[model samples]
Target: MSLRSGSFPRTFHASLQLLLTRRFGTFWLASLLSNIGTWAQQVAQPWLMLSLGASPWLLGLDTFALGGPGLLLTLLGGVLADRADRRRLIATLQSIQMLCPLLIVGLLLHGSIQPWIIVALSLVVGVTDALSMPSFQTIVSTLVDRRQLPTGIALNTTQFNLSRILGPSLAGVLMASIGAVGAFAVSAASYLPFIAVALWILPRATVQAVAPAEGGRDGPPLAGARAVLAQPALRGAVLTVLGGSLLCSPLLTFCPVLVKTVFQADVAQFSLTVSAFGAGGLLGGLLLMAVDPARDRRPLASWAASGFAAVVLLSALNPWAWALPLLFVAGGLAMTMANASANAWLQSQAPAAIRGQTVSLFMLAMRGGTALGGLLTGLTVSAWGVREALALNGLLALLALAGVRRGWLAVPRPTLAG
Candidate 1:
C-alpha cells in the first residue's frame, strides 16, 4: 500500500471529474444531503429507544425489522433495476421513504412514538431502501464510463461515509438543543431535495437486462444471482461480506447498549463514539478510492477481513475509556477499508449483464445478514451481556475469516467486459 507511487493526484482528479459530471453531480449533492439526514436520524434512534427503556433484544429486533424486508425485496429490486425505469423507480422509492420520517415527526411531537412505532417506521424505510439501492449503485456505471466506474463507486462510498462524519455529530447537536423531535425533522426534510434532484436530473443510470450467460434469456431475478455465483471472484466477495455482517456489522445495533450500560455515556457522549467511527471510516474511504483496480482485490480484502475481525474481538474487551478510540481504529478504518474494497472490487469485476443483481447480493450481505446478526447479537447481549457476546462471536468469526483468507485469494479474476 505504498500510495502506488503517483496515484493520489490522478485519483483526486478523477473523483473531481465525477462530481463535476452534470447528472452525477446533481445526484451526489442531493444524496449527500439526504444521507446526512438519514444518518442523523439513525444516531437518534437507539438513543430514543434507550429513553423508552428498550432492552437489548428489543433493540436487535428493531434493527432486524428494518433490514429484513430488504432481505426479501432487494433481489427483486435488482431485477427491477435491470428491467425497469431506474430513475422513476428511485424517485418513487425515495418518495415512499421520505414519508416515514414526516409521519414519525408527528408521533414524536405527540410523545406517542413508541418503540413499536419506531420498528414499524424502520420497516417502511428498509423496504424502500432495499428497492432503491441496487438501482442506485448500478446507476454509477451509466453516470461514468467503465474507466471511472470504480472511482465513482468509491466516491459514492465517500458520500455515505461523509454522512457518517457529519450526521451523527449533527444529531448530537440537535438532540442536545432541540431533542429527538428536531433531529427527526432534519432527517425528514433531507428527502425533499433528493427527490427533486432525481426528478430534475433524470440521470441515465438505467440499463436493459442482458445476461447472455443465461443463454440471453429473460428469466426471474434468481437468474442474476446464479450468474453472479458462477463467478468465483464475486462469490468469494459475497461470502466474506456475509461473515463480516453476521459477526462484526452488528456493532452499531448494540452501540447504544454498550455506551449506556458499559460506558455510562449519555446521548451526547455516545454521539462522540459514533463521530469517531465516522471520522475513521471517512479516511478509510479516501484510502480505498486510491486503490488501483488493476491489483488483485481479493488478497487485500482477505487481509482486511483478518485485521478487522481481530480488532472486533479485541475491542469486545470493554474498557470504556479506550473503547471509543478502539472502535475508531477497528470499526472506522479496518472495517471501512474492507467494505469499500469489497464493493469496488465486486463492481469493477462484475459483467454488465449481472451488475444489478450482483450489487443486490452485496446489499443482502450487508443489510440482511447484518440484520440477522444484529438480532442474534442482541439476544446474546441479553443473555450473556455485550462483552461476552461480542468477544465469543468476534473470535469465532476471526478464526473463520483467517481460515478462508487464502480461498478468496485463490479465486481467479474474471475477464472484464470492455
Candidate 2:
C-alpha cells in the first residue's frame, strides 16, 4: 500500500498505465534513447579528436566547448524556462540537437572531419544542452506527482548512468568496426524516437503554461541566484558539490588518457574504465534509493564527500591492472551520493515558481566546475603526470571534507508544512 514499501497503489498503477497507454511512456522511452545516443557521441567525439592528433590542450579546449557555454548561458535559459512552456522549449531544443549529429556525420562522410570541426560542433551541442536542460528539469514537474518526484529523478539518473555504461561500450565496438563516424550516425538517429514521442504526447496535459511575473520588471534576473546563494545550507551544498565535481568529472575525460598512457591499453580498455565508473554510479544510486535520509541529509552528504576523497586517494596509489575495479566502485559511489544529495537538497529548498532557475544555478555550478576541473587536470597531468593529477583531485576532495567539518557546508533542514 505504501509507495516507499515497493507496493504500488492500484490507483497510481492505473494512472501510470493510462499515462503510458498513450504518449507519456513513449516520450520517456524516446528521451532515454536520445540520452544514450548523446552519451555515445560524448565518448566518441573526444576519442575522435584525440585520434586526429589533438593534444591535451586541445582536449581541454573540447571540454570547455562542451561545458563553458552552460556556465554562461544557463541562467538566461533558466529565466526562459520559467517564462515559457517547458515541453515546447525542450522539443525545439531537441530538434536542434538532432541536426548537430547530422552535420557531424555529413562532415565525416565527406572525409573532411577535423579537430576544429569537432570542437565547433561540440560547442553547438553544449549550447543546445544549455537551453534545454532547465526546461527538462521544469518539465519533470508535469510528468508525475510530488510524492513520485524523488523516485522519478532517481530513475532518470539511473537511465543516464545506464547510458554512461552502454554508450561507451557500444561506441568502442562501433568505432573499432564501422569507425567513429558510424558511431556519430547512431547518435544522430537516436533523436528520432524522442521527437516522435514528443509529437505523440497530448500537449494539453504535459505543457503547463507559466503565468507572467507579477512585478513590472520581473525583478532582477540575478534575484533568484542571489536568494539561493544567501541560504547558508544551499550555499554550502553548492560549494561542496562544486569541489566534488571538479575532482570527479575529470575522470571521464582524463581516464581515457590514463588508460592509454599509464596502462598502455587500447580503446576497449578506455571504454572499460568508463563502464567501471558508470557501474559504480549505478550501485551508488541503488544504495541511496535504499536509504532514508530525509531526517538528516547533511551528515550523509559530508560522509559521502569524505569517503569519496579517501577512495580517490586510494585509487591513485593503487598499482596493478586489477586496481581498476576498485576505481569503478569509487567513481560510482562518489558521483551517485554527491550528486543525488545536492539535487535533493536543492529541490527541497526551491520554491516551485523559481525551481527551474534554481536548478539552472545548480547545473551551472556543476558544469562550470567540471569544465574547470578537466582543464586543470589536463594541465596537471601534462606537467606532473596522471598519478599526481589524480592525487591533486584527491586533495580537492579533502579540502571539501574540511568544509563539511567546519560547518561551513551544512545542509539546510526542510521546513515542514503543518
Candidate 3:
C-alpha cells in the first residue's frame, strides 16, 4: 500500500508505457467514453424508473433484466470470442446495444416510456452485452504483450472506473439541466467511438480463426467452465466474485431506492453517491497499476473481500446521508481491487485457447450474481426497508466469505509468467 517503495516508480512507468501504445491507447479511450455513456444511462434510467412511481422491487427487476442474460449466454460468448473475429464481434454486438439507449430516448420524447418498457430494453442490452463482453475482455491480451497484460488490464479497469466517476457526474449535470432524455442521448452517442475503434483502429485485436484447445474449436460451451473449476485458483476467484456480486453489487443497483426512500433525496444526491463509489474504484485501479506485476494477487483479493464486507456492514449500520459517500468509497475501492486482482490472475493463468471461455465464466459469476442479488434484494427491500435488507445482505456475504476462503487460500503461490 506504500507509494514510497522503490519499485513503485518502475511499475508506474511500465503501466504508463503500456497505456501510451497506439493500439491499446485508442481502444482505452474509446472504451472509456463508451463506459461513461453507459454509466450515464445507468444513472438516468433508474432515476426515470423511480420518477415513474416504480417500487423497489421493480427497480431491482430492471437491474436483473440488464444482467440476467449473462447467466445463460456468457459462456457461449466466450466460445465466440475464441473462435470468431473478436473485433467484428464486439463492433456488431455493441452496435446492437447502442440501440437500447436510443430506443429509450425515442420513447421518452414521445411520452410513451414506462418502467416495464425500460426493463424490456435493458434485457435487450444485457443480451448483447453478455455476448460481446468476453470478446471485449480478451481483446487486451491481443493489444499488449503477455508480460504487460496485467498492467494493461489494470489500466483498462482504470478507464472503466474513471467513467464511473465522470459518467454519473455528467449525468447529474445533464439531468439537472435537460432531464434524463439528455442523459440517454449522451449514452447512445458514447457507443460510436468504441465501435469505430473495434472496426478500424486496432487491426491486430481482430482475429479470424483460433487454434483449438484440448478440445476442438467447436467444443461444448461449458468446457471452459469445467476447466476453470478444475483449477483451485480459478475456482476460488470465481466463487469469491459470485458472493461479492450477489451481496455488495446490489448496493449500487438500488442506490436510487435508498436515496429516494431512505434519505428523501433527489438526483443530485444519487449522483454524488454513485460518483463517490466510482472515485474509489478509480483509486483502486490506479493502485493495481502500481502493484508489482509478478506478485501473487490471491492474498490481495482475499483481504479486499474482507474489507469490502466490512464496508457493506458499515453502510447498513450507519445509514446516514453524510456518511454514505465515504462508506461507498471504501466499498468501491475494496470491491474493485478484489474483482480486478482476480481478473488479472485469471487472464494470466488461463491458456490462450480457452482464455475467452475463462473470462466468460468470470463474467457469469459477476453479472449473474449481481442480477440475482438485485432481484432478491429488491424483494427484501419491499418487505423490510433498505437498511434492514442491507444489514442482512452484509451478514450473508460474511458467511459466504467464510465458506469460500479455503478455495482461494489453498491456491499455490504464483510466479512471474510471460
Q: Rate the local accuracy (lDDT) of all candidates.
A: 0.79, 0.70, 0.86
Which model, 1 or 3, shows the larger TM-score? 3
lDDT of 3: 0.86
lDDT value for candidate 2? 0.70
Q: 273, model 2: CA deviation in Å?
A: 1.2
lDDT of 3 by residue, 1-418 (tens): 4456688888898899888888889999999999999999999998999889888999999989999999999989888887777878888889998998999899989999999999999899889989999988988988876678789889998999999999999999999998999999999999999899888754644433433333326566567567777877778888888999999888888778778878889999999999999999999999999998877788888778778877877887885888998988998899999999889888888767778888898899899899999999999989998888888888999888877887678868432121
Error of model 3, residue 127, in angstroms: 0.6
* All models, RMSD in angstroms: 2.0, 4.0, 2.0
Which candidate model has the greater lDDT, 1 or 3? 3
Winning candidate number (TM-score): 3
Model 2, range 301-416, lDDT digits (tens) per residue? Answer: 66676777776676667776668766766767777777776776676666666666777877787787777788888898788887788877887788866865567543345342
In what order do the candidates fall by lDDT, top score first? 3, 1, 2
The TM-score of predicted model 1 comes to 0.94
Per-residue lDDT, model 1, residue 83, is 68
